[model samples]
Target: MSGWTWADVDVAVPRPGSGLPGVAMAGFRQRVRGDVEIAMVAHPSVTLFLDLSETGGIVREAGGTSRRGSFVAGLLPGRLRTGGQEGSGLQIRLSPAVASVVLGAAAELTGTVATLEEVWGRDAGRLEERLRDAPTWDERFTIATDVLARRLAVPSRVEPEVAQAWRRTQAARGRLRIDGLAEEVGWSRQRLWSRFRAQLGLTPKRAAQLVRFDHAAHLLAAGHPPAAVAGRSGYADQSHLHRQARAITGLTPAALATAPWLAIDTVAWLAAPRT
Candidate 1:
């Protein structure tokens, strides 16, 4: 039997090649022989969890709702967890900027977990079948990339100014001033606020908070002291960090440090090169 540990899982990423910005893909196969469960922390991305397992597929739970098989998780789906008997899947992370175009429903998807079928209709089932049938991880990655590239080619409904503002907010690690972002994007503050919320599904301020919280969460998981994390992540102080951590994740800084969801990030995300 395969060991019931993250270290026993096989992780794969796409081969180096030109690909869309604001998108990353990783493939994961659990080596464990039986049941598995994992708590998922919030991240500042719209994530697609595509199940390609031959046996039981994955199930996700959030906001007291559970969805089985492939699903799309919107930004900041709070306190989520996933489990299954044993399974393998591909995870695709899309920045909100790109998700607005690729998903064509980023604003509607915010803060919710929807079955892949809900998002892509019959195409969801077809895509999962193709991925499952692929003989190798590399082939699956290529197929996923091609699909995403095609979707991204659709004309974006997001304003260039809004996309630019989101990029700047992320580049600053959420430390940027919203007014400055509006100025840089050549939009009035009101226009930026309204358009950003309409197109990206969250106000600029909330987006910044999510980005900042994500950074702080990773630092805590990496074994940094909460006080140090607060300072580095731009919170006013340790207490400020504590409040934000609780608000965003409903977990204390200490608990977040040991979160199982983040534990695999080094293997599944950090080490993998983005396609």
Candidate 2:
């Protein structure tokens, strides 16, 4: 819990095992120097637009996926099995700073799923332009970082103690107790939960659930057996692990095992906890 430092910040490719569903990497594609790629993606549970930039209005459909060709800024978590017309822009991965800057101060941003309609509601074209035509990747990242940082009333409101406790539990295979973490912070459970929810959106225990599941996915992707993965990833058993996977991702472990890209960002996000 020292202040935020570069040592605490990191960017990583998606970890294959985190059981959360959908993709981990966020990408932007440009055909020319500035051509935008926008499309609608249909998942089993949700249908959303993968609007990368807002311009030139050339709509194309690839397979079941439709490319509406708009602009994009922030993308939420979900299964992305569809694609828009390919573009040339680099899809840069974000650090926690970037997530925090773009997402505001919601510790757990679940429940509210992000989709194409949501982007259109916010008029994402402006930000999409910035991401597409920005002179450098750093420039786009910085702008995104600044936007979220400014939107959230308190950027560092997420308690380091809470995150640290969650991190410790994750490192220990989700065996850390909430009471132990509360004592370390010198606060009662009620107080800690309040602060944790307000700052990060989810309670410490729920955060631990996310961490545990993320680890489960990573282990599974690494070729561990289901029983072994369940035990190591903090599940009660194979059934327990299967239930959690379905609840979070709408996909069974068997389906996910074959999907290398599934829940790719969930692992990256949890492993870092930067935002």
Candidate 3:
């Protein structure tokens, strides 16, 4: 039960100058002397891990399958199992608003983890090589930002109205009502639901719940009591929060308060969106 030392998580935070909306970059180099397991809690953004280690080997279990190499993980409903002792890479988070355009893929990848090779083909390998060759973390960040910008040049943009809906839902911290979201977007409830699911890979209700769960989880991790976390996060009551706790991370609020993964996030993704 050794704790992670600073050396275990050499981190490079995201560059504030990079103005790429919906994209954040962090550089991580890790070395493990023993086995470690991490719970990949549900999150609102799509995640991409670009392998930069000497060996392109790491195991990710999500949606009943294990994937290796640099990979793209869509928004998930619950934790995934990450079993690996060593690896170093750039982890990127993309809001669903623009993930499809940036990856040239679909948000339909929800609950699934697929290799970067599958998503970006040989280009993915080439990008990894470029990032690995960069002399410093700053250099890597610049390269990643440039690559994403290039990919976005010829983008597959989503509808502006749907994008607005997603942004509003996020701003509300998942406390949004679908009917109200539809009203704000000036679309019928049924239309909003179908279009949101079609473009974002998640139904509006599920997205709201996921966002709510994320806020509550972080509150618990920050040492807030479950009752307070529940009230502030829009849960009906403490009991409601307990149900979502099990649903999102398979742990009670008490257990999640000390989750190692969330602890790592403090330094590893310092600027990542929590709400």
RMSD of each: 2.3, 10.4, 2.2
Q: Is candidate 1 or candidate 2 better by lDDT?
A: 1
User: Across residues 69-161, which tens digit of lDDT does each residue of candidate 3 receive?
Assistant: 788888883558765557677888888876888776556678777888888889998999998898898888888888888877884667887
lDDT string for model 1 (146-168, tens) is: 89889988888888888888877
Model 1 stretches with alpha carbons more than 4 Å out:
1-4, 271-275
* The 10-residue segment with the lowest total lDDT in model 3: 266-275
In candidate 2, position 251 carries an lDDT of 67
Error of 2 at 214 (Å): 0.9
- Among these predictions, the greatest lDDT belongs to 1
**Which stretches in model 3 have alpha-carbon errors above 4 Å?**
5-7, 63-67, 273-275
Reference-based lDDT, each prediction: 0.85, 0.47, 0.79
Ranking by TM-score: 1, 3, 2
Task: Put the candidates in lDDT order, highest first.
Answer: 1, 3, 2
Provide the lowest-lDDT 10-residue window in model 2. 39-48
Candidate with top TM-score is 1
lDDT of 2 by residue, 109-222 (tens): 333333333433553555566666766545655554444345544555446665555446546655578888889878898888787666545566766676677677666766
Candidate 3, residue 48: lDDT: 89
